[model samples]
Target: MNTTNSIQQALFHRFDREQWAELRQSVPLTLSETELVDLQGMNEQLSLAEVTDIYLPLSRLLNLIIDAKQQRSFVLNQFLDHKVDHSPYIISISGSVAVGKSTTARILQTLLQRWPQHPKVDLVTTDGFLYPLADLKRKGLMKRKGFPESYDKKMLSQFIADVKAGHDEVLAPLYSHVTYDRRHDEHQPIRQPDILILEGLNVLQTDADTLVESRKPFVSDFVDFSIYVDAEESLLKEWYMQRFLQFRQGAFANPKSYFNHYSKLTDAEANAIAANIWDTINGPNLKLNILPTRERADLILTKGANHLMDKVLLKK
Candidate 1:
């Protein structure tokens, strides 16, 4: 084995849009126009053409990987002459706040569920695992809501563990964006899905001290596959501000909204506030906690300013 060749092979396989589109294998569009409209986030750009060209192929690839994993598990069980339960295949999606991970997860879930073998796909956002708003305020971490310190890492780990163990049912707390807090009475139940799509800003983050020895597993440990959506920091900032302004017009306008005050703000005030929040909170969180995990993803989808997949890097 040549050293240089081995080193090069360890790196990723890069594909431009046209090259990646060639990988699509007749995976039909299952989602309708109405559903696509609902799936897209405010101010985020997504089109059916992009979905057919980019995501269809990605879904096909995931289906192949999932089938292979199942076959391997079957063979191993036969070799051992024992029954070992197969855990749900977990696919994680991570990126900066406005990098379109939510839309990606939703589209993937729909495409994946259309596959014959993996029908019970579910999408779960790690936002539910964030510490309640009161808890954050109590700990003086209000400004750091999206930071790692703001989440209950232990609880999130356990939730993944339970789901991986094939628990009959697992419940996750619900977080309300309108109220900007965890809902006291609502919960989302995971009923042993065939595949679980976990989407969030920090799904790929690991402990700071990776060299330390410990039995504790991070959330990514349960992921069978992961995707990191990527774009330039400046583009992300623009999208975040755009989304914030849209929210101010709609959700924030509700009298009961936690950010109701923002609805009353002038255009200049709203823009300033969005910029300040991004500068002080979301921007730093992306740099320090999120972007560092991009290389760890099984696949990296690099987006252009128009929110199209400009290129993809698949781990070799």
Candidate 2:
């Protein structure tokens, strides 16, 4: 079998229930509580064990690719008489909301950093590229927040292109979940790093409309590898609803919570509302716009009913 199939077979072969047990021995996790807290948006706290098992080997394998890519590019550059920085490899992680793409990105970032050659792995979510709620409202897209039309596609494309071009620094907007919007006045500047994992719902979009409107190269064109988190629609709906209720009881109870208004509802009420929203908005976006891009990914991590990855599909 090829390397791709070998990786898939290794992952799938270890997918028995409680497979994390076997994974733990191979990929020891040492994430501190603070690190987990920092990555909470992706449920990093809940999935650490699985992260060790699934992402560690994957990270090691990617480092090998990064090295090979650099060597190949160096040989080509020698032939053409040109020079370019061998900057970090980038991985794009995409999936429907609450499918745990964020966590996967964070875990992979942390794991890759543990490798000697890629000690400076960094993660940036696509949320920062989303238009602020205020902008969305003015554009009359408040009802369609989180949809493809709600992003500043031009800016997002430019950001990716700048990073790929090895700009001294690339700035990205910061988002405030409390305000449920972008913090326009503040930005985070990323210098070049050894590895960058860009994670988001629509990170894979490259439709003609986007190309025309953004007027820049598609982000995926820069990805060295990409992953799409896969799970049954029913399981995703359940996870989304459960996470909604959890957030309501925790974050939403805070006055600063953007979703504080929902804090007053009972769990049943929150579940119903979350389900309805998912069915109308998130589910449709995943089905119509996002999942079609699954074929563009280099690897897929498919979760079972227990919310564990049971099978991994690698593209040939």
Candidate 3:
């Protein structure tokens, strides 16, 4: 079979944009333009039409799933003649850098929380789980910042386990993009949220080496649902470069920002630097680590060159 035919026969049920939009049914658009603008990333162009067509239906589906799971738990508790503690339903979103994972996470968090059954949704990024700058430097992993080895996998896994065990309060480490490191004195307290959305570059990664060596569960193991945002490598490169340039004029311009030195670079120099970073770090990580995890996700959101989602592939 040809490549396209093989993909069509894969485990996912593919839906084009129009077909996916039709699934929205009667779901209302709860987000205003202002709210969507605030939720967008540096170079993203998220629109109300996109949310109405794509995210609303997704939210409705998630609501039904959550309700069904809760009902199942209740029935099981009755069968066991005991009250089991309720745990948060974890949803993980994974993708390459600049693939708009954060945008999708934030939008979903907002939409999912609006549902009456589960009004409390929390969002956390895996950046906070990355090792401190000093630790990375000591371990000689500075250049491999976003790689799986750079993260404190044990701590991250334990955190998920705690949250999944229905802990009354769990603290997640805080990360600062401005400083490009984890904050030692700060943490976000998660208090029994109905749903938790975990966003990261490698949340779905299941490295065989790590699993064989550690013999422990991966972070994705606790995730009840997972999504992967995807795009072609060329488009991802272009988006990364665009975001880098925008940051040079915006966030990098801050004197305290870790990347402040890049603010003074001319357009050509910035582009060169961005391209080198992508080619050396992000690109390799994507090809070796992130992309491999795409098929592991319960759903895949594929984007076009214009940074708009064109299709969805949901696991059958």
Predicted model with the maximum TM-score: 3
Residue pairs clashing, model 1:
none
- TM-score list, all predictions: 0.94, 0.85, 0.97
Which one wins by lDDT: 1 or 3?
Answer: 3
Summarize candidate 1's per-residue lDDT along 193-256 as a digit string, tens digits: 9899999988897765355666689998889999999999999999998888899999999998
Tell me how far the alpha carbon of residue 131 in candidate 1 is from the true structure, in angstroms, after superposition.
Answer: 0.6
Off by over 4 Å in 1: 1-10, 83-86, 209-214
**Poorest stretch of ten by lDDT in candidate 1:** 3-12
For model 2, residues 179-217, the per-residue Cα lDDT tens digits are: 888986898887898778899988787755343565456
On the 0 to 100 scale, the lDDT of residue 220 in model 2 is 76
- Give a tens-digit lDDT track for model 3, residues 1-316: 9864376458799999999999999988899999999999989988899999889988988999999999998889899997876699999999999999999999999999999999999999999999999999999999999999999999999999999999999999999989999999899999999999999998997646354666688988899999999999999999999999999999999999999999999999999999999999999999988988888889899999778989998888
Q: What is residue 16's positional error in candidate 3, in angstroms?
A: 0.4
- Give the Cα error of residue 227 in candidate 1, in Å: 0.4
